[model samples]
Target chain A: MLYTVLPLEEVLEGIEQEPGPTVQLTLGGITVEAEPLGNFQARVVRVLSTDPRHFLEPHCQPGFLIHGQIV
Target chain B: MFEQPEAEQLPEREAPGLQTIKELGQTVTPGGPLAEEMPFHCLTIIGQIEGHLVLPPRNKTTKYEHVIPQLVAIEQNPKIKGLLVVLNTVGGDIEAGLAIAEMLKTMTTPVVSLVLGGGHSIGAPIAVAADHSLISETATMTIHPIRLSGLVIGVPQTYEYLDKMQERVIRFIVQHSRIPEETLREMMFRTGELVRDVGTVLVGSEAVRAGLIDEVGGVGTALNRLSQLVAQREGGMH
Candidate 1:
């Protein structure tokens, strides 16, 4: 996948793509393929990596979902 | 024979078992009596910090969900004069670690962190999140680059995303600690420090020398420092 786990701020301020078959958002310095998971929330499916495990171990997979409502 | 029975004469509402249970709970968890009016609140960050995902039952984890609400409550509670963050973790989710660190950074109550055993990886940021940080003489810290363990798409953008996340951690550590960005980066990217990894391991005074930790001390020092901060804050208010 080519998705990145975006912070809540990035998701709220993400640049929306033009109307298309799939949702996309440019955030956290990368263009991510987004799927609406909830209200004001999305699941990024583009950036996938095993880097997050370095912090913890075993189960620290990179997250793609970003959820937060903008004020 | 004299007056009423001694046990009956005691308060009707209080139970003796309550004290035993409270003591047992305190022994199990770091925070003593959460409801009790105390001068400082203890927040212990142990095991892996489970962020958005849930870890296996065998793996001990600290859920950010729980910590976040406790932080909010600690901030809102007027009785909590200060916060004592005790860290003995190997790090966990980066975002979750950063989230906890950020909340501590912005909290109005004074926070003091004490690194007991090992504060590695993401735990580094949290250890330095407090106004004053302490690391035990035998404690060690590992500084390394952000790594991925699962399936990874080999592409330029992937590395870019990783670099951005790494920068966030570096920036936060540099801003809060006395270590310069260059020195911290060097420690992070240094090789041969670990048997099979590309990073540096600082033990005890080394962390203090590297400017990552404020002092080389333990619980006594951390508590004393927190007391001073709480007193200063209270004094300022007066």
Candidate 2:
């Protein structure tokens, strides 16, 4: 898979309007929909693709929540 | 050659000739003093990588202007069997490092990288650019989102530019190394790893487990692997 680093703010701005593409991400069976948040520094990796039960797994929990502001 | 005058009466003008003779005796061929004894393969070390127009710590980092030529030379040179890169850097100019990494990725010669101390920031992409990668047991690597150091305008265009640059780095890393993009992104934006920041630090074994590095070995292992790769490539050619 191709990976790219993008500013959180740009992603957030995109998310503020409409949910773009379905970002399929998996952390040990916990599939998440990487939706863009209005805030540029944050993106909501909401659990969309997996059942709520998957979240109970130790590795499937919210892996990391990064916080930062657009510069 | 002019004969020297008596020691005490020698003219000062003769000093230059005498000095030239001494220099001639000391000077060796451009190949260097131990060129024959030492191997012809090149192992360039770039210590400092200050950005833009500025030169860094070792007086200079690997500038694309210089590095591109060197890579071409290495490719053409029959003596250079393989390339071993040792990185301990905080990352530098994005374009410069990317250019160097691109060359390394495409080079015919086997390339190996060893992270001696720390390979953080853009250095992450560079460390994985090689054909094979290794890290010392004590070395550390950091995965973080792109950060612009100097004054940055908060305009939409600026944000877009930064995003594009970030994508390039991520794409390169994911393509070259075994690490997955989403996993890397989690690490990049992972909170609590860096106080008041979104990044994670992985030690030697951790880096290996994360798939950022192939093995946890130092220079010796790195060299051995490089040599083996070269031999394999040569055998394949035949």
Candidate 3:
């Protein structure tokens, strides 16, 4: 398998910094949509993969203990 | 005996002023505040999500500019514990809908979404963006490919652009919801589903079965889930 020698943070920085497609098309005063999907998808993938546990963790706060602790 | 506000009574006057503001806001927005100033805030995403372009006057729109700021406030507000997002939209401006969905997905506060009526087009992502999502038994969600209106130049690049945009929507929905990417793509590209459009409309339990929605429920279920989340958070803090 091929791998880059760069550190994980550096690799992530590289992906984050990569410029996306910049296309400009004007049709009858309506500028064509030009969203940077490639960069966004890459970022989302990184977020999902690196922190699967975090993403899966429920957003709600921990529940209260129903039973009282015996001192 | 009821005590009225006197010229010397400042607290009484202030209370009524605050109530007036809340009442006025309730009049303008679809969902209002729950009784007794509950920590959970309710946001209604109705009609079209208007972006840079102004939709027709007759159309009902949830202007992105307005919603974006409200989201920021909800995030910053210390008193707000959770969010309840109610969606009933035909969807509009792909980017705008995605932006809202992204904000909701990334929010630290627990969010529970309930889809009533229809969640079509870009509304699909918004519905699934919440931590827990529900749909009414009669609610329907339309999964369709991205489409452009007016002056279509038959070019390969346009199709490529559309595909990329559609891919973003599918990626977001699959990442947030239980639905798989392949199934969502199939629904988006499905044929003979709509007489005029090429897409599939999953209603209520069907959406849950397809894994697009978390469960089949209504307002009570959505509120109960959100309250539970809030309690869970409070439990965690202690």
Candidate 4:
């Protein structure tokens, strides 16, 4: 699975209205749930996997989500 | 009955000369006027300078953590009339040394640097960082290229990255000191100076001749120059 990282502000600007509990991000087909996580800030953080079409065999370890916030 | 105890009984060892072990300790105390008043406002010395966090064993270099706060403190304190920078460093981390040099370049207070034992590598920038620089007639300075320590990728991208970093150092040194970029580059890449290294080793008078240092003098000359600069600045203010 491929992932995309983007700044929170950029993601918000692209979305028309307040996203729901699970908002589908535009870059690198990523669907993140706002309910499960907290609000995004000005920095870039890894959200979820990118587009489903390109999603290959899951090479990542199970039971853990790769998420990173900019320092 | 004892046939005069053999001479072996005359003490096997000569009196051990007064073995004196001197342990010099540095004490930390709260700031006070007594601490603030001194002949020289502040003395900044770069003992050993290697341009990285983890230094070589037996390597002597200045630690940025130790020098940074001192520079900031000296700048903010109005009581500090002069700063004396003593350089006896071999120059380690370029960024760290340059950070220190940049701070010294911008300091409002007068600064004088005296290169003692040896000021080489990034020490070149530090030696010239002050308003007036001095060196002992026997001291030496080495002008060398940027060196990498740990594992480094050898791809084109890696080379590009290193080139950019080197450029940053060169730009900073040129901006702060009188040495021109071309001359510095020539010195940095000069071959056969060090047995296995590609740099130029300049002795005392040579360093001054190369425009890397101001004059050939020791502590007294350095302090005198700093005092003069301080007096001039203060006089202008009054």
Candidate 5:
């Protein structure tokens, strides 16, 4: 159970908001799982790799836009 | 010439350094990697403390595993004179929050917690576990009873652990801070204070008045108090 000061409404806000169309692609050698913004641009969901350094990459930070081919 | 070709061939290797220069206009590099380190290990517990379960990708969560080890490292590290826990959280799993609060209370290292925005629910216990607790002028805290989530199938015995869970939170907070059990309980059951829930929301100085937080101040006040504790401990050792 969430023991927070925030209202229940705020806590559960985006739970059902959107069923995001997510995709996995490689960008800058890191396996990035992202949601496509357009043909070549996508917003990063997460950097799916074992390398901790890859996760620390600013470009791979969640919500960061990535530009690359859909592979 | 070989090094130049390698760097040119691999653009990904240069991204971090190139972006650092673009933003901060400097590079610490390998020679000064520890230059960015500070005497005080500032640990922030923000967002929702989601415990073991990984929340959605968009959810900003402070997971249990993410912080518990840091507390251990801070205790072992000689260079870290004190710990500054900056909290702006909408509390999460009771087990996770209490584990953190218990560790904070037991650690030999001096701790000062600063509450900004809000340190509600389980955050309350963690805040008070510190040597000194400070709250930002506009920050808030919520005092509410712990209730079980999900289904309760058959017997009345289902609530047995729930009662114990709540007791842990209350026992920890009261032991760590000056807030009396009666006062905390009254606040928890104050139905009129909250529109829908049975609870009270303490804003800044109200928390101090309730004896849950030590002072109505922010980052500067917390740091000053922490340094004083560190100095006092060092002097005692000497």
Candidate 6:
């Protein structure tokens, strides 16, 4: 049950479609799901960790480029 | 919308401390990285707050389970002085958002929430949950009745269910913030503010005036306030 103010149509517009290519790997002691930018670099999709401080790291933020790929 | 600073501009700088690009953006040289040490943890609550079901991969989501554990970890870490919650959310699941808000409210650590873009619907509760709340000059917060976005349960009792859910959210906001219950109700049901919806849009200063958010400011102001709060807490501890 969605309680958001955003229109459901817009939120779920692509729910049925394919999500394209992505890779899930462990980086900096955290799990990172990213969209490959090739040449060994990737744009962060999400940084997963149980530690809240990890989210504070500018390097682990979503949308920031995570290169020096560690799988 | 903020840039990643000078280091991001040049590729060579990324590897100065990190021997390889894959060393996870950390500077591991013996001298230590030049980055300033932040006293508080910066936890971002953005995109959709995924509830019971996993949102499809196409949707950007903040899973409740992921956040709940992190909140617990922050509380357990004594070195972490405060928490900076950066919210730019459309407000997904009610239970999830409220749970996150409740966690922040109950924690002993000082928490500051800053609304950057749009903190709408369920986001309102989370925004006011902070020890201090701030909104960017142009950021907005929409207060409205919660709607069943996709399906209707098709029963007379459904309205009651939705009403009860709405009440819970409104109650939470009023309990956390300085907003009067009556004013909140009026803003929520007010018409003409949104073309397709019936509600009031409180932009930055409006939200501050309405007592929904504590101040009108951005990242720098928020960080400064967070530092002050951390100092206050430390003074009390000693």
Model 1, B1-238: lDDT tens digits are 3553465565856656434333221122235564346778788898777776555434456778657767877887787789999988877788999999999999999999999888888899999999999999999888988875446799999899888989999999999999999999998889887887788888999999999999999888999999999889889998
In model 6, pairs of residues that clash are A68-B21, A68-B22, A69-B22
DockQ-derived CAPRI band for the predicted complex in model 3: incorrect
lDDT of 3 by residue, B49-141 (tens): 777555544556677755665677677767888999999988877788889999998888899999999888888999999999999999999
Winning model by lDDT: 6
Those runs of model 6 whose alpha carbons end farther than 4 Å from true positions after fitting are A17-71, B1-37
Q: Is candidate 1 or candidate 3 better by lDDT?
A: 1
lDDT of each: 0.73, 0.65, 0.69, 0.60, 0.80, 0.83
How do the residues B93-163 of candidate 6 rate in per-residue lDDT, one tens digit apiece? 98898999999999998999999998988889999999999999999998887886656878989988888
Off by over 4 Å in 3: A1-71, B1-36
Q: Which candidate number would show the highest DockQ if scored against the true structure?
A: 6
- Report residue B211 deviation for candidate 5 (angstroms): 0.8
Total colliding residue pairs, candidate 2: 6
> For model 3, what is the error of residue B164's alpha carbon versus the real structure, in angstroms, after optimal superposition?
0.9
Model 3 clashing residue pairs (backbone) = A61-B232, A61-B233, A62-B232, A62-B236
TM-scores of all candidate predictions against the true structure = 0.67, 0.65, 0.66, 0.63, 0.74, 0.76
lDDT of 1: 0.73
- Ranking 3 against 6 by lDDT, winner: 6
From the highest TM-score down, the ranking of the candidates is: 6, 5, 1, 3, 2, 4
Predicted candidate 2 versus true structure: per-residue lDDT over A12-66, tens digit per residue: 2332344344344444445554433334223333444324344323232222332
Fnat values, candidates in order = 0.00, 0.00, 0.00, 0.00, 0.36, 0.60
Relative to the true interface, what fraction of contacts does candidate 1 keep? 0.00
Q: Any runs in candidate 5 off by more than 4 Å, and if so which?
A: A7-71, B1-36
Q: What does candidate 5's lDDT look like per residue over B120-223, in tens digits?
A: 89999999999999999999999898865545555767677777888888898898899999999889888888887899999999999999999998788888
